[model samples]
Each structure stands twice: as C-alpha cells, then as structure tokens.
Target: MLTEELLTLAAAAGAAVATAAGTDAWEGLRARLGHWFGRGDGRRGEAALAELDGSAAELLEGGTPTGGELERCGAAWRDRVVATLERLDGPDRDEAAHDLRRLLAEEPTAPKIHSGDQHVQGDIRVHAEQGSLAAALINGNVHFSPPPPPVRPEG
Candidate 1:
C-alpha cells in the first residue's frame, strides 16, 4: 500500500502535467517515474528521492506561471525525479516500486474502446486473452503502425 501523502502527490503531479502540457507530456512523466522507482534498477540515493517527492508535490499544488511554459515545466519535473532517486538506498529504494505502482494506478483509467466491426472485435478478444499483450495494451503500450505482412519490394 502507498502512503496517502505519496499517492496524493503523485496524482496531483500527473494531473498537473496533463493539464498544463497535454496528455503526451503526462505519459512521458509517468514512464520516467516508473523507470526510476522500478525494483530492478541498481542505483540508489536518499536526497534525490526526498527532493523529487517534495518538488513533485509542490509543482502539483503550486499555482505559479509554470514559466517557460512546457520547457520549464518539463525540466522542473525531470529534475525532481532525478534528485529524489539520488537520495534513496537499499530498502528505501526498493519500496519506491510500491509507490510507483500506486502512483500509476492513480491515472484515470479509460474503458477499452472496441470497434463495432466483427473482425476488430475478434482481434480485441484474441489479444485480450493473451496475458503479455493484454498487459502491454493495458499499460498504454498499444501503438498505431502499419499492419504486419504483405510486403512488396519497391522500384
């Protein structure tokens, strides 16, 4: 479980970023935080963690101009993330995983949208049944690109 303070800060940070810079920036911020707090990383620090948490909370709640617009906002947010991770060690760092999970869960979830077509519905059903693929999609890794197969050499 995550502490109330931490969850509040994380949620606020996410909301603030999205509100200020649009959803693209918010998703990037989440990914960076997730990477930092993930358990597998070997790096550790204390001051960095505290600073990040503090700065994030402040930014989320602060009513400043968020000057330099997107650039400053992005830099400030990134700096806090780096600083906070710099302060953690061992157990504290490990515990960041739970914090991140809770923070990520705070992002508003959207119901999976399905196409009305039968083929699309079938594809969704099939992919949703695959654990790994489903997890990736659920985590927002679903991307748009050319469909696989049927390639031809160009002159």
Candidate 2:
C-alpha cells in the first residue's frame, strides 16, 4: 500500500505532467517521465515517449483546453502514476519514488505567490476592480499617501 506522502507525490507528478504539456517545459518533462517509466528498457522507453507525445497532442489539439478537459487529463495521468508506483516493490519502489521526487524538484514550475514568501518568475498581473485596490510587490516596498486636494481656481 502507498503511504499518504507517496500518494500525494504521485498526484503532484500527475498534475505536473498535465500542466507541462504544450509549454516550454514539455519536452524536458516528457523525456524525464519517459525515462522514469521506461526503467532501463529501450522499447518500454520508446513506448512511453510515444504515449506522452499522444497525450500532449491530444491536450494541444484545440488550443487551450477547458477546465473539465484539463481535470480529466490530470486524473488520467494521476491514475497512471499511481498504478506505476503500485506495481513496484521493496527497494525498487523506494528508488522509483526518489527518482520521481528528484524529477519534480528539478522541473520548472509556474510562478507562485505565497504569504510572506512570494517567488514569481514570469509575468504577473495585478488588477483591481472599480473602487477596489490591488498591489503586487515583487521585490520592493509600497507606500500610500492621500491624494492632494484639488486647487481652487482664482476668481
């Protein structure tokens, strides 16, 4: 049985696979995932690559995908990852999990904004609705001051 941590990691890997499709990171992620799944078998590696390519092609077929489609794709890959992990045993499973962790850590991820520790590496947009306020502090401080009063015209 897979531990909670391993399950979480597999789910994340699945999501990463789905998210990386069609992006600049796609090729690297695909190659790494294929290599991992291949497990030193050339034919298996080629087959895995082909499967990944098909997934990518399907994902990118109609331009941007709907949220439902993306979720479906993610779920499918998540199941595949879980199945792969479940098939291994003992030291093999441990080593495969380690490799998966390494793969995830090495791959580039989209910009993330977290409380007290925001690290953005790509374009970020900050928009405020009417009568609202918005702020995005990349690496700077912000100061707020009252607007100057309108000057009255001399008679």
Candidate 3:
C-alpha cells in the first residue's frame, strides 16, 4: 500500500494530466508523461503515448465537457497512476512519485480557452492572467475595443 502522501501525489498527477489535455501545454506534458511511464522501454513508451492521446481525444470530444466527464477522466488517470506506483518497489516508487511531483510543478495552471467554430448564445466568464472578467452576451458576432489611454499625471 502507498503512503497517503504518495497517493495524494498520484491523484494530483492524474488531475494534472486531465487538465492539461487539449491545452497549449498538452504536447509537452504528454511527452514527458509518456517518457516517465515508459521508464526506458520503447514499446511501453509508445503504448503510454497512445493512451494519453486517447484521453485527450475523449476530453476534447464534442466540445466543452460536462463536470461529470472531467471527474470520470481524472479518476481513470488517477487509477492508472496508482497502479503504476503499486508495481514499483521501494526506492523506485519514491523516485516515480518525485518525478510526478516535478511534472505537476512544471505544468502551467492558466486555463486555455479554444472557441474554435462553436457559437455561444449565453453569457461567458473568461479568466486569464490579467484576471477574471464577465463577457457580454453573444448573438453571432464578437468585437473588441482597445483599452482607453492612461491619464497623464500632473507635473
């Protein structure tokens, strides 16, 4: 049995993988995870890559996923991580857990929004580096106005 800390780490890795799918960081995260899971085996590495691709495809299917879908996908990956950790012995398990922590730490937390060709008919809230803000309702077209010029300071 794995320690609580290690189990938590595995859970976080799984969540991170689920969150990284279809985002800008997806490719890099996917490659690193594949290599980690592969553990120097070429066939295993290829299989891992295939599995990751399938996860991404499932999450990206249709469009925005429902909350249940996200939870299910995350749990699936978490189980995979836990199983992998269970197979390792002593130091190997610790090292794998450490690697997972590193991967999670390096992952970008910023959410990426891809509108693609979908049309939005309701209000949307956008969260970015600048901060969260409310978006106006959309009928069909979208427009953006430049920020007003900064006020000059009195000399």
Best by lDDT: 2
List model 1 lDDT by residue over 1-155, tens digit each: 43334433333443344333323334444455545544455353343344444444445453433433323444455345444544666677446634654454344421121222111110121124345653223433455543222112121
Residue 129 displacement in candidate 2 (angstroms): 35
- In candidate 2, residue 15 scores what lDDT? 64
In model 3, which runs have C-alpha deviations exceeding 4 angstroms? Answer: 110-155
TM-score of each prediction: 0.31, 0.69, 0.69
Clashes of 2: 0
Q: lDDT per prediction?
A: 0.39, 0.68, 0.67
TM-score pick, better of 1 and 3: 3
Question: Model 2, which residues run further than 4 Å from truth?
Answer: 110-155
lDDT tens string, model 3, 12-57?
A: 6666666667666778888988988998898998999999989878
Candidate 1 stretches greater than 4 Å from native: 1-68, 109-155
